[model samples]
Target chain A: MENIFRIIVCIKQVPGTTEIKINPETNTLVREGIETVINPFDTYAIEEGVRIKERMQQSGSEAEVTAITMGPAQSESILREAISLGADKAILLSDRAFAGADTWATALTLKNAVKKLEGWRLIILGKQTLDGDTGQVGPELAHMLNIPFIGYASSIEHISGQKITVKRLAEDRYETFEVRLPAAISVGKDINVPRVPSLRGKLKAKNETIPVLNIADLSMDEKDAGLSGSYTQVIKIFTPKHVYEVKMIEGSPDEQAEELFTKLKQLNIV
Target chain B: MEIKVDKTTCTGCSLCKNFCMYDAIEITGGKAIINDNCIFCGACIDACKFKSIEITGIHEKNFDFSAYSGVMIFIEQHEGTVAEVSYELLSEGRKLADALGSKLYGIMPGYELKEKISGIFNYGIDRLYIADNEIFKHNIDDIYSKILVQAINKYRPDIFLGGATSFGRTLLPKVAAIIKTGLTADCTALSIDPEKKILLQTRPTFGGNVLATIITRNARPQMATVRPHVMAKEPVQNAENRQTDNYLKYSDRIEFLEFDPLNFKTKYKLLSREKELGQSINLSDYDVIVSGGRGIGGPDNFSLIKELADSLGGVVGASRAAVDSNWISYPHQVGQTGKTVNPKVYIACGISGAIQHLAGMQTSDIIIAINRDPDAPIFKIANYGIVGDLFEIIPRLIKKIKNGKGIT
Candidate 1:
């Protein structure tokens, strides 16, 4: 057991399209017929996790990658998909009590689930989810677990006994940092290109049965698992309205180009 | 929380089903039943006209909030100068502090910042806390979060604000989690709730298609990170006026703090730092930007966008679609997941604007759209729209500008 290392990748299932529409009468999102897929950013995380596992195993050390997600029962599809992408095992944390969890509660639930696993050395997640678009859960989960976190990691340089070096992309510069083990990292899309599932891997994944964990399984109290544990609540949700007065420059390409240049000049733009 | 629907009141008209974005409501046997998919967003409760859908079990917890006071903002600094977003936070924080009848404070943890401390007061910060040490030089999350959590526990500010920069987004959530509080990210709007006397943080979700207003009722210090350029910076006030009104010198307002770096042991160590190469031009810093999208056809066509930008003495930007297709690098991407820019002039070439792409550059002073499709959504938000092939129109425009013949 001491020779084995475990890498956990946290993922989410998000609506596949950005063309979400609101019902004109009800003024709410039309979720019907919308396809769901693993968040695009999380794909990079899964790839990086699998790459790390392969790199370590090549050196004659034991390593495994596990994919974890918290969503509806239907979300098991993504976990299976993760298995096809090289995850050795998958876990689905789903319960009626886990509904309405904000970032805080979501992180707490993840913390509890991670604690249940043995020989875990590192955790990986996407920098942010498309649907929530809040990039807080990774750092929050790390804090809850009392470990260091590095966000927006562009590359993982090396991993050795009790230490890992990661390159992070900041607003103005790229910084390289060395962190101790039992740390969490959230990666952006630039890290790696996610690989397509191999035919053999897909067959193995189709036959794999992912274990489902609920709040009770993790020994988490009911209040601390879902909406009751959430610190922030959404007070209102509405569609944003934009108003602009546009002037159409209608003519031949030359005429339109001339008019655009003249207008930009008038505005002192170009 | 528990949600229940009164079978007697539910007409099975399925009105509530239309409002549920989660697809949790099912009209089973002429009654609306909520399944496990419900996130308890309360949207159905509002949609039900008969008040049939109700959520219970939201009990108020007993927590003492009176121990917290004042509004505190994290002043982000790199090298020796303060980040521009910090000033914007100060300006917004000042308003929030004034509205709550509380004092506005700022916290800066850096090295050799003695000379730069007083200038921040011009933005209406009452007291600035300094943790000037050599170890505070780099923006290390492990060390910074520990220092911040210590400061937060000791000072206990009612409201905490930070700019939604790369550093803030990573650091604040760590602090919030350690302190067991709620934190809202990339807030576009902040105001004090008149009735509850609490902070209401509003931000866009679902790729800017929806806006959600959030509140932390029981948390000690409600935390929020605001996006840069979304809020206006207040005009800098003269030292004479501020000193005369306060009857105190700038030095009197400074509070120097001491912390033992060894106590906050962190396994994190900075190995190296380097500037991003190749793309030296920061799109946000430029006044004029020329962007291309999927209609640019391929990566090779980005040269046209770059040529036009260079001719205009601006920079090149790209829509998410173009970046996703590898037509351009991620640094040049402008959208929800990318940089939010507010340049003086924005030129869209061959870009059928998506809502996510529009969220980043809609705030530019002037927008010019060039697309073959007359009904492109970009035209709706653009000030001047040219319905023509970008390949032709852009070359002509660039040739005219390069010829330098259309003079004043």
Candidate 2:
């Protein structure tokens, strides 16, 4: 009998636009009217996860793909989007306790929720969250789970019954590694191009009810779960002041260079 | 848990001894003996055969966050060369340490770095920590993280800093996970909050659209990875201006981490190490650099950029967009995911400055931007801005330079 794989993918919701505004008094993001989307990198993770399930099924094996995320209730939209992209199940871990959580606390909450799922064969996540740009959660989760982790994986080479091989990316080169089952990998943008959801998949996702888990449901210690448990906190927010004055030279293509040339000569740089 | 060697399977090839960073293993009578200095990094386990070595036992514990003080910078060095980002962090860290009235220490882990130790002291560091061992010859994240965590537990630094390079990005998060602390990545600025006596870690979020200032009020070692070239390097000076005798602190008493070996077991094995080969162009070493972005149009269009660079005796660079479009190889890329260059003069041709691109090169001595769009963010930072097409402007500039009318 073939072993059925239980794959879990983590996703997040981020502002669709780069222009994020913060309320000075609250020091929090002004999210009342902003549009949101699944983090660009998370889409790639979802595509890879769904592809893995389809590949296994074609080979006469059973596999289930579950998409999980930690955020506000509105974040369920991304979970639905994941389901529409072929995820077999969707879970949203949301709670007031999870608010103001940094990467450390966030990873712990997800780790606890994952423990309840039991028998998870593999975990997939985006290389980093676009909103925070921390790239810490996946590695932290892998450490907390005591499993081997491969980050910024560009390709999956082979997968057998209890082993897998992947091409991991570095700054200048790629290194290949083989690891046993029950591992996790964070995929990069280059891994695969995501496919659009079909009409049927979208319809199913729109009607599906996502199960929401809270801190209490995960049986987590209050001291280890949210803002109180977060090791770091934000002190303030402000624009970085420019240290040097910018001198804008106004002119035509030829004239602009001529002006720049004169300035460089005066500065003894030419 | 303890790491034990099986007598029956041990071939005594002496491979384990060669890989141990600490003198924690000795092959006597054709069997490896574990010493007290062993932090259980598991490097020997990966290099062993015959299932001779196995880790047994487990120990769970917590650290007192209030006991740690001082600011420590992880001087990320590889193959005996310290990265430039380390110096930048040192200069910035020096300010933070002074603001808090605490001592500043530098920690370096690598092999064959005896000669480089003096070079680090030139930055005016108070204390220097070096872990010179064979296992540190190449960066293996798992081993390095264990060594770092143990060092933190012993020294109790209130604040820690590292470069946001590939080595630091992978290593620090793992260490933070074990220590149960927070780590802010790719910070653009760092400072100390006087009232709270906490580290202020400011970094960009939301694809570099907004900046968030974070503080580790509860954590002992408030950690951050600052991007290279964003901060200024301390000016080099004579040895008399530096603390020359700080190296004596580690003369005979090397603090090797004393921890249980079983907790550090890892299944990952490094098959090989490939040095970054080829591409003679190192952006940071050049004094003058000319870069092209999507505005350059195509791969062949880069010739204009190269011509300008050649005329000035400088190097040609590219933005991430140009590299992603296959217009040029990644070696020419200069951005957040690419190289952070700190040249004396940086010329941007047709590159609409995205935050990601600007974060990499905003610290240049002088910036010259030539773009058609006046409102492009690149113009705001340009010391000399020209609102024009690069194709038309670059050729005229090249002609003037070649004729020795503008540049001598």
Candidate 3:
């Protein structure tokens, strides 16, 4: 019997448009005008957290869901969006010191932020982000916190008191794990279908104010909080040159397969 | 500190056995053996008659990055079958090693793989490191990362490569974190600088809208994972005997090292694992793949794509949209987040070819796109573009294939 089950859902705002252009000289994304939204994967995480909170409430247990994001101040919109989808509170870890951070530094910042909360039963995260597909943040954060981590969680089977059972998706198999409280999990998109915000919820979200946290607020120093703490550095970015060329087989469907089959035979791929 | 014995150079000298105070050295058969109790105190090295023992210190002050050599590939296996990406990586890794004038090595961890990887030497690997332990049968990220980190630290390969499969995606990041090195995910191309001997890793970013070439810059034993089918698997040809089958016996060029995993630890435990609920289709094996998208309308329409796939003797693939819509199974989805397929011929029906989708199948030999919208992004990459209703076009393609006029 727990008085309150506190869960933290981490979210990130990534570029929404696919028409991203690179600055040829610097080899960096031109993020000036592109629209940004919550990372697509994080939406599933947010929904899962909210769903767990609802399940706790239905069972007559006091539960609170908090959504956290580490980005610029503009990322508050996604936190507010999380609120609209049933999050009880939202916190934004925003500061110039956190810019240019790699997954390690980002995890450090998130770990410090989580420590500031004092008590939390679980932390939920998306499998990975679109901008950086490293999939290292959740595990790295767990490493920092010295807690158990389960990646690729497909479903939450049950949660009782301080223990949670989850189904994780592996290659060609599905594994189930039972982890104690204070553990972190990164959920896959198959976990649950995120629900759309209702009109009433949207109205409430419009007026919500997200609290902002800076390096000073969490007592984290600059050297251990951002790019300075990161061990690996990206030296260059360029377009991958095509290793081989492809030949087109033109004409109707009948002619297309005919040409493809002939070419396959010629290449000895058949 | 670490203690090692070079099997090739040892000459069955038992003189060093008398110097070990802990009785860690034993004369087994003819060669001198170092047991687990050896404290690496270096007394035996001073007394070694043949001078076969090597001592390496782990302190940062004595560590030399220059001592690390060779390019290593992690051969991932599933249900006793080696993944195709392992061979593909070997093919690509050989070129990188040759450019740097380094030997190429492979590390495979599983329960039993002696027979499965017998043909690995044909790929030009100089040595094969194996850990055939029951703990490796299941995909446990923490345990696998621990073993790999130990192997990497011991072998000290300059560059390590793995396939960007589900296991690698989770495992490599943890390894990189523990070893404190750089790891690039889902790389499409790899090359050596030749001048500086750096691994140039290239991969897609920004939702597959842009490609980025990243370099480790400072880390030793640079690691990278490339998607399956991104590189062609070309075995080294043997002029002495050209076998009709792909597997050629080149055992002389390869050496084996059995990795000992007695000192590894992990916190998480796998309570149970069950087979996937639905049918599992290995999309990588098919030569021709027919995939549908949201344009197919509903779950019932997937049968149409199946009919076309059956007529072509191939498998049915679906877009993330179709899979999300519950029209098809998750295993059938083909996209950046799904499966990267390099089929001989790929037919995209009603799929708008999102950048995510293109990232998976764009490497196919020939892409034939059929969509009602002529300006669909898929048309840009399709060798043959069809602007018509898929319901109308797919049926005609299936009928023609069934009549043995277009396919056979």
Candidate 4:
């Protein structure tokens, strides 16, 4: 075993698109039946982690990579999916006591799990989950763990010993940063394309038995977890009060152009 | 029952004293004396100096918020893994639990359930309902819907909330369909209804043109999906799981196809990626904002916008017309479907008052809009609106603010 850094990569599954249809009868999204994919952003985290691990091994450094996931009983598939991506190990944080957890709570759980992994030197996460799109957990987790948080990382620049640097993308510009090890880095969807699992990797991951943890074993109680421990409350969910149909004017190119100019003239659009 | 009173204009109006039967008020030193016993009634609000008495409604008309209820969060997981939005939802859920009385529960189904359920507990979820089954694994529409459909039927919860995630955005509709109910999507605000026993769903319509509050009148389980980042995340003071439920059984009706990993090229890619080595979408990751309006003139002048954004280490934003006119790129436009930004600072340049534009940035923490016209509708929402030419104002203002230290 060489001195490659020990890293943990976290990923999540999500709906792929924003323009989804709603079940008119149900008044909710018509997800009952559509395909769900890994959150586009989280895949970047997996890719970056795997790349780092691969490079470390190439350089003759011993780097151990693992995937961590927190989800429902059905979510183990995600860990298996992570394993197929070349992670050496995967851990699932499951328990009835961990339900209804918000961002801070979720990060707290991840932090606790990482704490148990003695040699963890880095944690990689997606810039944001497509579903909530809040992008708050990485920073909050970093703050909680007293570690540095690098957000919106577009690419990894260099990694040497306990010092690591990355190029963070921020719309038309980039900021490079150097931080200590064991830090959390949130990457965007464009970071890299996650490759399909190889047959060998798949076979190994399929045989690997992932472990699960609960509130009791985590030394946490249900009283403060889930809804109780969260600081903000969602009092209600309702449709917006405003209602006005979009009336797009359509016609032949000339006619459409004429109508546009007419409306512009009428309203002095210019 | 929290109240804020302006101390300067209090004329010792005792009407508040008469209205508060809870003995939660005081009228010491010529101001309305609000005590702990005051029950947050608006009776005294109509009787104060310059009508400074504003009664904020903390509770809605559905659930009795003070009572203990299970922290029931509609899990927005992807392929069985928890989504970041789920964490945000849990953060907000935890807060709601503390405000009223409740425990957080993450509900999902699949076979061979893992410990992801417990991970959420550290985020403060008190319980998990992990129903393991094959159909629940792939987010199987019919199977997953039926499972939640069955679960809700059995659990009979007071409230069920999900994130506006893609899965949530898609699956909730189907689950609600299976249950034969209505669901609110993209809610910006949520409140508990003390009497109605319903979930109030507020979503913007006409592309954020208007905010509508919807309520499921007769549904058994009040279901709604909240937009991400709309609510503040709560910190995990401590974590503990109160209870957890295990698999009772699995249904064979649902088939799970362990999804073959996605090939990047097969999926819908963005129109184009940024050419610069270190570039990403700006609006996707910013806390403060400084936007530009038509006042700068012509799309070419947008370089001014870039300069300003660079100077402040912030993102540049534009009104609807700016994008429609092709003056700026599409990514920078802020509107209903265009983008929903809640930055700490929003600066509007030369843009006139347009409801569509206002719909997008009005919710910003602080709005500083500039226009030659003082009566521009933009000024209505602006904490600070300037009436001057952008050419004359921006450069000078930027220099002044940078040199003086504070613009406010």
DockQ (model 4, Cα): 0.03
Between prediction 2 and prediction 4, which has the larger lDDT? Answer: 2
Which of candidates 1 and 4 reaches a greater TM-score?
A: 1
Among all windows of ten consecutive residues in candidate 4 chain A, which has the lowest summed lDDT?
A237-246
Tens digits of per-residue lDDT for model 3, B21-67? 33567888787888654534354665565769875432222235697
Per-prediction interface RMSD in Å: 2.4, 13.8, 15.5, 18.9
Question: In candidate 2 chain B, what residue range of length 10 has the lowest lDDT sum?
Answer: B249-258
Model 4 chain B worst lDDT run, 10 consecutive residues: B263-272
| lDDT per residue as tens, model 2, B340-390 | 676888999999887668766877889989888988878766788888778
Tens digit of per-residue lDDT, candidate 1, span B306-396: 9999988888999999998988888898887676787888999988988778878887788989998998888877988888899888899
Residue-wise C-alpha lDDT for candidate 4, range A1-270, written one tens digit per residue? 345578898776554433333323432322223344566667678878989988877887888778887765556777777778878898888764554444545667777777777777888988666544545566556655756666777677877657678775443444566676767788764567679899988898789999897776677756444433333333322322222222333444344334433442343221
What is candidate 2's lDDT per residue for A109-209, written digit by digit as tens?
99998999966788999888766778888888988998878888878887755877877656655577778888888986678879999898899899999
Of models 1 and 3, which has the larger DockQ? 1
* Whole-model Cα lDDT of every candidate shown, in order: 0.85, 0.76, 0.76, 0.59
- Indicate which candidate wins on TM-score: 1
Docking class of 2: incorrect
TM-score of model number 2: 0.79
Worst 10 residues of 2 chain A by lDDT: A22-31
> Which residues of candidate 4, in runs, are more than 4 Å off?
A1-4, A15-20, A23-28, A32-36, A239-242, A248-251, A264-269, B1-408
Which tens-of-lDDT digit does each residue in B126-162 have in candidate 4?
6666565544454433345556666666656656778
Q: Work out the iRMS of candidate 2.
A: 13.8
- Order the candidate numbers by TM-score, best to worst: 1, 3, 2, 4
| Candidate 4 positional error at A145, Å | 1.4
